[model samples]
Target: MRVRQAKRDQLVAEGVTPYPVTVPTTHSLAQVRADWGHLAAGAESGAEVAVAGRVIFVRNTGKLCFATLQAGDGTQLQVMLSAAVVGADDLGRWKSLVDLGDHVFVRGEVIASRRGELSVMADSWRMASKALRPLPVLHKELSEEQRVRRRYVDLIVRPEARQMVRDRAAVTRAIREVMHARGYLEVETPTLQTVHGGANARPFITHLNAFDLPVTLRIALELHLKRAVVGGIDRVYEIGRIFRNEGIDSSHSPEFTMLEAYEAYGDQESMAELTRELVLAAADALGSRQVAHEQETIDLDAPWSWLPFYDGLSVALGENVSTSTGSDRLRELGKEHGLDLDDDFGPQKMAMELFEALVEPGLIQPTFVCDYPAIAQPLARPHRSSPGLIEAWDLIIGGTERATAFSELIDPQIQRQRLVEQSAAAAAGDEEAMAIDEDFLQALEQGAPPMGGLGLGIDRVMMLLTGAGIRETILFPFVRPQV
Candidate 1:
């Protein structure tokens, strides 16, 4: 209420218009400051420059004062002001009106101060937008939780946080550019689905008042993109948000972006090669083949290792988890890992959990684990030689699962049976289990061609590239309500 009242008072005192016209911006603070040192010696004068930024800090030294402002490109610049330079006519007016946290535009000449600091000498200035309440001040005394909660304030003061955001943006751009270069068409899939049947993750449920139906937020883009591939839309991808009803930790979020792609006539091997290429391209854009996160440096340029899922299981379990082992052996292995191998626990579920508990996190470097059990990958095609294994590969990086890809199963009979099995799992109180999508199965029956598909976590990739922890990479990460 106080903030609202202050905003109203500001408008009244300044005689600000109800609707303000647009102002054109010339250059960013970064472009100006990058050459500030060289230009300060023989600074340009009498040049009209329009700069706009949110005022972060303000300090007055009698008749002279200084304020630091943050521009759009995350660049901070100090602006110096004196009563004499502002003019006696407007000095009193400026002194009465100027406040911290306000967005202002200044038309000025680039110049150097007495202390050899670069600054913009104002010829004319106007408030673009007024910030009613003072923001949290810049100081070294703030706590970590306070800083994380008030990230906008932290971005103004912390260079590392600002750089992390910038780097994340760059990596996102690099991904799109690489996909576009490879002739992949960017597409949008539905966020709300009647039957959410992609991937193994519980979804956030919502209701549609208009349709009088309950819908679930998409947990993955795989099912729909594969449908498109069946419709003859080759080489397509979607960088979209997926919602999962899951526990939050350093690596998990309820809502996050997934970059999923599908290519016609390709297989898991092709997808793995593409994943490596795309990651390497992003690493090059980051200007380093390696990225630091915590105490470890992930070598992105290093040759990615490819190992069969069975081989990885053998290494971890001390026993071979072959398809020929039948359900009894798989159940025993699950029991050894403290996993409940129930009646619904088929070869796929048992093998998947075994991988998660054993082999997944052990992959500290970039490695692709392939030949997942067909039971584990319902939508993936089975390998010709290994009847029990699907042509699937999951790219694990820095002890985390980065991406999952596979050769899509287009045989309508096989797809139906897999969906039926998945439906049974969902019926058995497994919320993360996939639901049978008759529409998808119908599309497959329409003679969908064999294709390769990939789903990569964009958030995790950004986390790796920016060398920031999971919470740091994401802006506005969900937090529980404080009472």
Candidate 2:
């Protein structure tokens, strides 16, 4: 650090700007390579162009110097500074002042070196930006802790890190394209709300000073987006951040991106088709519908399988199970299957725990587990045929719940009753229960069309596409403070 600072001081003393306000550039490193890379060895294009990038590699011989410049997208171009072209004095200054991490601007004729490496033969160069600290050792792997703490450095040093950002954007754009193509209106919803009655997740609470009322960072976009449907926007969707006061793990983050779309006059089956299309579209954006994850290849183009929640549980348990199964019997079955069932767990909760442990892991292919217990999803309509089940499905891929859809419950009276039950649970010390939101209820009362809503975890989708963990999908995921 001191050595770099001394070099910066030396440049200032030499009447050179170490941190110039601006520099002219005619092409990105990518464009330069795309246009001039085909030149034969020892051939010069005579196309003088300006380019700027961070210096990643440098070597100086007495009369000639070579420095590799890397652009933000990880494109590299070699800059050859010959004493004849740049003059001996400037060439010498470049060797002395340029560092691996410093940004430099160069004006040069595009050419291929004697060894056939495409390069820029410099006529002039200047410092664009100086770095006070050295970069990490090149080609050395960074520890997970260091990578997460210094993501800027990670993005610079790791090609995969830069690609992850591009892939995420591609996935998001693909989702929006699918939504817009289906005539869904993309919209934004309030991040802070008086009541967070959407998903079954605890919210991060905060105080609103002006209104002098407690508020929470929204845990889901389901409620407000549904309100839009009630307001006559037949189809609406939101790709936004959701905050949950929850535990962190390989697949869970306290804050993450979610895509919630509600289509009026659509049933759970309609949303399932949309969910399939979205997944395939995202996979297509990443250049393949087949993804490699955890030693398995997931074929998004293959026909997806469907299983009722109880039937899946029954298969996993090697016995028939349904809503009629008693809590005590379910607990016995759970214990036999190696689950430590909580005493307070009801029949539905116990069945779910057993299913998650035994069934979810083997659902490597795209499978829609349908007809969950009615209490499991308060916002879903009752199953047309099954008395105790809801018209909902959880899309499980790569052994994780990637998305969920519901035949939305629009009957105001039934919706209120469900929220009332959820409110009681919240009051009874269930932190992950939804609270009653009067405004949402009023919107339902104003008459909403029969709708099907789906919420997809953007991060989890990235994880599947990139074979990365939840934190790696996020640019700057939350990390614990250093002690």
Candidate 3:
């Protein structure tokens, strides 16, 4: 670091700008390769082009110097600096001042070396940005802790890191395309909410100084998007951040992106179809529907299976299970399955815990586990045929719940009753219970159409598409503070 600083001081002493205002570039390194990559050995294209990138590699052999420039998209271009072309004085300055991590600009003719390696033969070069600290060794792998803490460095050193960013963008773009194509209007909602009731998750709360009221970061995008449906935007969707004051793990993050959409007059089946299309679209964007995750190949192209929630739980437990089952019996089943069930947990909660433990892990393919118990999803309408089940489905992909949809409970009276129950749970110390939002209830009272709402975890989708962990999918995921 001291050596690089001394070089910067030397450049200042020489009346040279270590950090220039602007270094014009005519082509990206990728563009340069595409345009002149066909040149024969010892061939020069006679076309002068300006390009700039971080210097990742350098080798000096007195009169001849070679440096590799890498662009943001991980494209590498070799620049050949000859004393004959750049002049001896300039060549010496390049050798002395240019470091591996520094950003530099080069104006050069397209050429191929005697060995037919495509390169830019530099006529002139300048320091675009000087780096005081050296980069990590090119071939050394960064530890997981270091990779998340210093993502910028990870992006620079690991091609896979850069590719993950591109893949996430591609996945988001594909989601928007599918939504727009289906006539869904994209919208944004308040991030700081007076009441957070969208999903059953604890929220991060803060005090709003202007209103002198307590506010919470939104835990889900469902409520307002549904309100949009009530306001006559028949199709609405939002791909935005959701904060959950929850535990962190390989599959869970406190902060992550979510895609929530609502379609008026649609039911759980319609939303399920949309979910399938969206997942396939994202998979297509990543160039394949077949994904390898955790020693399993998930074929998104194949027909996704449907498992009725209670039936799946029953199969897993080797006994019949339903909403009518006693809470004590469910607890016994949970204990048998190695689940540490809470004493306050109701039958529905116990059933859900058992399903998550025994059934969810085996759902390796794209599967829609439908018709959950009413208490499991307070916002879903009652199932038409099943007495105590709700019309809802959780899309599980690669053994993870990637998306969920509900035949929305638009009946204001029923919605209120459900929220009342949830509110009671919240008061009784359930941190993950939904609060009664009077405004949302009023909106429903004003008459909302029977809509199907879907919420997909964008980070989990990226995880499935890229076969990366949740933290890798989120560019700057939350990390523990270093003491």
Candidate 4:
């Protein structure tokens, strides 16, 4: 509403359009911040700067007024104006036309305020964009629920929220840099596929008008990244999005970012080592290897502990928790744990429930739970020494499953059989069962190299780095649709 009025007033009085189609920028917030002290120390001669940002706060002292502006790159600058330079009429005009949340370009010189605050003394300013609605004033009183409900407002009021997101961006950049340095080529893959074959999760379905068929959003990037390995990319990675139609919780999002990487001739051990290194690198980028989250400190330095899956489960449960036990015994154990295990929740599923419900939550330290049950790892190669186990590992940190990796199953026949089993499960009413992908099996037949594959939750990593709760880390976590 204010934007329309501003445009009309600009045209009527100044003969200028409020919204100019184009504007060129010479410098960023980072550059100016870097040279801030030098600029402040310099003589107040003819230093002119063109800066654009949203007006965050305002203060008026009769003749002189100050407003805080925030640029896109997470930098804040205080803008000052004096009636001696701006003229009484122009100052009144600014006060009438400008509002909080308005984007404006200012021509200014750097100076220090009476309180020794660095400020940009403005000679002139013009509107870049005008906001229609008033931003919610969250600083005064806001609940956690309200903050989540109005995240954009929360971002405006909470400087910590902005800082945490910036930290997340820094972590992502560090991940890319480390991967590039390690010779991994980043690639993109299809998000909507005919078959969601990678992970055990229900997928969101959508229709493709162009293809004239229904397609499911990908649940994981594992299958396609491995296909890139088959296409002869020695080391490949994808930082992408995945959709899972499931319950909302402290740890899960319906649509989330995933980081999946595959390296040829690498095993679960190699992937576990890389996971530790990458996580540590991210922590270092955040300025410390020590991060405290949820009442505990996590040291991401080096040499994370590795425990065999059965052993870790046993340690957590105070008893031997092995899937190698007979099917009947596994069912009995599941029943003891109050898990309704029938022929439908097969021996493998029963064992998995016992481990997940009774064991996973106890792995608070950074530990790799290695060697999963064969039935638990559909895409992992079988362990050579343990016939019933697969060479897969899950990295557990702060009692959360942060990442999972494995030596990939490259045998086409074995891959096909496992997929068939999943298909049967789906037919038998397991909605989260992986779909059989014939094309993926064909690609496997064409020969994918023995490779280590990893799928890491980037948001979970951010949660660890920022010491933020789950919803706090995400910009707009999914909520129930309003009636």
RMSD of each: 3.1, 1.3, 1.3, 3.1
C-alpha TM-score for every candidate: 0.89, 0.98, 0.98, 0.89
Task: Provide the lDDT at 396 for model 1.
Answer: 87
What C-alpha lDDT, on a 0 to 100 scale, does residue 104 get in candidate 1?
A: 71
> What are the clashing pairs of model 3?
none
lDDT of 2 at 27: 96
Model 1 steric clash pairs: 348-375, 348-376
Predict model 3's lDDT versus the native: 0.92
**What ranges in model 1 sit over 4 Å off?**
1-11, 14-37, 40-44, 141-148, 293-296, 324-348
**Relative to the unseen true structure, what is the C-alpha lDDT of residue 258 in candidate 2, on a scale of 0 to 100?**
97
Task: State the weakest 10-residue window (summed lDDT) of model 4.
Answer: 37-46
Off by over 4 Å in 3: none
Identify the superior model by lDDT, candidate 1 or candidate 4. Answer: 4
Per-candidate Cα lDDT values, in order, are 0.79, 0.93, 0.92, 0.80
Model 2: residues with Cα > 4 Å off, grouped in runs: none
- Residues 1-483, model 1: lDDT tens digits: 365356547667668741247556676677667655565454554455667788877776667777777875667777766777787555554455667777777767777666666678776666677665566655654576665677777776677778878777888899999899989999999998999987888988999999999999998988888888888888999999889999988788888888999999888888888898888877887898887755477787778899898899888989866766667788887787777676666676677778888888778789998888876678888887787788888888877888999888889998898888778888988888899898988888888877889988888888777656677887777777667
Comparing 1 with 2 on lDDT, the higher-scoring candidate is 2
